[model samples]
Target: MGKYAQLVIGPAGCGKSTYCNHLYEHCQAIKRSVHVVNLDPAAEAFQYPVSLDIRDLVCLEDVMEELGLGPNGGLLYCMEYLEDNLHEWLGEELEGYGDEDYLVFDCPGQIELYNHLSVFRSFVDFLKNDGWSVCVVYCLDAHFVTDVAKFMAGALQALAAMVKLELPHVNILTKVDLMEDKNHLDEFLFPDPELLLHQLAASTGPRFRQLNRAMGGLLEEFSLVSFLPLDITDEDSIADILGQIDMAIQYGEDAEPRIRDELEDGGDDDDDDGGGDGGDDI
Candidate 1:
């Protein structure tokens, strides 16, 4: 048996932390256990229970002061430092977790880490070697995907993470409730490439419209990525998103046996109490 985890990742202000927070709360509401690990060393606050914190190993402020690096540079350094110490520090941190435990690793908002960087890849490989099943949950802000160009860009970003991570990937369009016209998101959520191209032609200049056509064609040709809207405010929406993730990671299969065991044990106790305890009391 292996531990299951979702690496919650996205750009800054895309609601990665908020997604983790909501997922944590939803799990609690349903009486399911899901633990969160804050992988962002720069995180200063937490809204959910943290099982493991990267800040304990490396703090961005401390790194910046010691190395005299700027914010991004300091963050990159901290991630690399954490990567270097994965075997020693992370191994011990994960020791407390067991099979059937579901972990949500709330990652930093470094686009480089998700693509064009080996740090996160190496870390993910380490987790795999340690018998953990992992999935990548890539988030994009709903407000950012309003236009055709932005939709193409967001899709490509998701595709990039998929290509780089090489894990089970789930893309989420988050903060849907914050969108100016929530009803208008349907077109982007389940996009029509033809419609997108037409919109692109109308919106942008001629030179860029050609580029948009080329990129849009590439996206249509690949047809590998899509986004699920996440309001987070709606329980059904959260459950639907979680269902997709659970299916991708085969979580239901792992849970069935545990549920059966508990039910059987409960039945045995009920039978014992009714027959033996009742007669003894009489």
Candidate 2:
């Protein structure tokens, strides 16, 4: 059986950590074994227990201090450094987990990494070659649903990441519990191109009308992007999002048959033992 992993990624403050924390707790509640890996070198605190952290290999603050780079530049440098040492550090660490293990990688918020960089692409390729089913989970702030323009930008970002990675992708609207108007989410969740184009035209100048139409058409035509709303306070919401990801990666598909086989074998042994006891009684 192959292992499974989900790359939890989004912009900073999009609740990646919170999602990880809740996912970890939810998995535990359901008696599921899961491990979370923190791929963010700059992350100082976490709401969930991290099984593996990038800071142990390279620290962003130290890189910024020693190499004299800004936050974004430092994060990029840290990831690049990780890429260089994947076989030495990450590969060895992953060997500890079995084929049935499910890993959740909490990645940094740097959009550049997924947008135009080869770092995460290389990392994902490495995981695939090592016999793991990987899925990309992109999170957007739920508040973006309130504005058509903001939602479009977030959708485009998700689309870019999906195209670049070429993996089983899941998009999430995080922090739904914080939204003041839940009704605003329905339109964005099940988007209509014409409606969005009209909204965009009203929000922007006439000069950008054609561009908005084109963008809206792209979203509607491909039909590749949609978001699962995530409310950390709601267990059903979390379970629904997790269920979508599991289906994307086909997690536990192989185990079901194996479990059935084991049950059948045990039943056969029980029947044989019962026949022997009945013969002895006669």
Candidate 3:
């Protein structure tokens, strides 16, 4: 049996940490065991109690102060440092969890890590090699739907991560509750290429519209980009998103046999209790 994990990733302010926090609360409410690993070394606060934090291994602030690097550079350095120490640090910490444990890794907001960088790819490889099933949970702000160009750009970003990670991917449109007109999401969720092209033509000049057409065609050709809306205020919405993730990684598939085993043992106990002394009573 392998442990399961979802790497929560997105641009800054896309609600990645909030999603993890809400998921932690929801799992606790339902009595489902889950652990949140803070992979963002620069993260200063969290709404949920972190089970494991990369900052404990390598803090971005410390790296910046010592290396004299800026925020983004410092963060990149910290991730690389963590990558270097994966076996000695993260591997040791992960050993504490059972095979059935489900881990949610709250990743840093740097899009470069998922799109082109090898750091995250190496980290994911380590987890998979260590007998863990992992998936990418790509988060995009729901506001991206309001603009045709922005929505296409977000989709391309998701596609980039999918291509780079090559793992089970679940794209989420976060903060849907903040959108005044939820109808705007419908077009992006189930996009009509023609409609998108028309919108692009209206928004951009002719030369740029040609570029939009090519971009839209590329997206259509791949046909792998779609998003599920996530409204944190709605428990059912959160549940539906979590269900999608669970299916992506096949999280609970192994538990069915264990459940059957328990039920069989219970049946034996029932048989012993009734068959021995109460056999004639009934």
Candidate 4:
């Protein structure tokens, strides 16, 4: 019996915190117990309940003050510090769980951690070795993906994360609730590659025409790149996204089957008593 973890990761300001908060509420509404672990040492505040916090081990402000580092530099330093002290820091934080507990780790917003760096991957491997099933939830801002070229960039970044992680990965388009007109979103949501290439080439000022076509061809070759639209305000949309993640993690497959209780009362025999009928039959 191993615990389950959903590693919520994404670019900066891409609604990772909002998604974690929404997931916490969603699980609570469904009567499912879930714990959110804050892994961002630089995170100032969060809206959800944090079961485990990295700041308990190392705080970014303290790191910045002591090491004379800025916000970004302090974040990188904190992550490196955690890596050096993983056994004492993250190991202790993950202790005392009964294996069935669900944990959602709200990771840092730095894309490098997921792309070229192995820090997060090492953490993931650590969890897996400790008997926790892990799933990577890569979120991209939907607002930034309104245009064809931007959408392509988003897709490529997501692909890079997927390749780097090499685990069960899910791409999510976030902040959809903020869309003024969803029609533009629909085009990118279910885009046809050829049509997108034509649109990108036509929209760009001829300098990027060749580049757009080449990029579009690469996207067509790899069809696994797709996004699950996320609207934090919509419960149904959240459920749908969770459903996909649940499948990836096989969330409830090990649970006991639900049984219906049998009613022990409520039948009446008006014609005769149950015991009397046996003697009166003759």
Indicate which candidate wins on lDDT.
Answer: 2
Worst 10 residues of 4 by lDDT: 258-267
lDDT of each: 0.88, 0.91, 0.90, 0.83
Question: In what order do the candidates fall by TM-score, top score first?
Answer: 2, 3, 1, 4
lDDT tens digits, residues 1-282, model 4? 458989999889999999999999999999989999999998888899889999998999999999999988898888888777887777877787766799999999987888877788788888888888988998989986667777888888887888887778888899998988787676676556898887787768888878888888777887768888899878999899989998898887765332111121222242245554554464
Misplaced by over 4 Å in model 1 are: 255-282
In angstroms, give how far residue 125 of model 4 lies from its true place: 0.8
Better of 1 and 2 by TM-score: 2
What lDDT tens digits, residue by residue, belong to model 2 across residues 1-282? 679999998888899889999999999999999999999999999888999999999999999999999999999999999999999999999999987899999999989999899999999999999899999999999988778898899998999999999999999999999988886678887678788888888899999988998899888888998889898888999999999999999988888999999987787687687774554454
Could you tell which candidate, 2 or 4, scores higher by lDDT? 2
Candidate 3: clashing residue pairs, number: 0
What TM-scores do the predictions have? 0.89, 0.93, 0.92, 0.87
What candidate 2 gets wrong by more than 4 Å, as runs, is 266-282
- The segments of candidate 4 whose C-alpha lies over 4 angstroms from its true place after superposition are 256-282
Best of the two (1, 2) by lDDT: 2
| Prediction 2 TM-score vs. true | 0.93
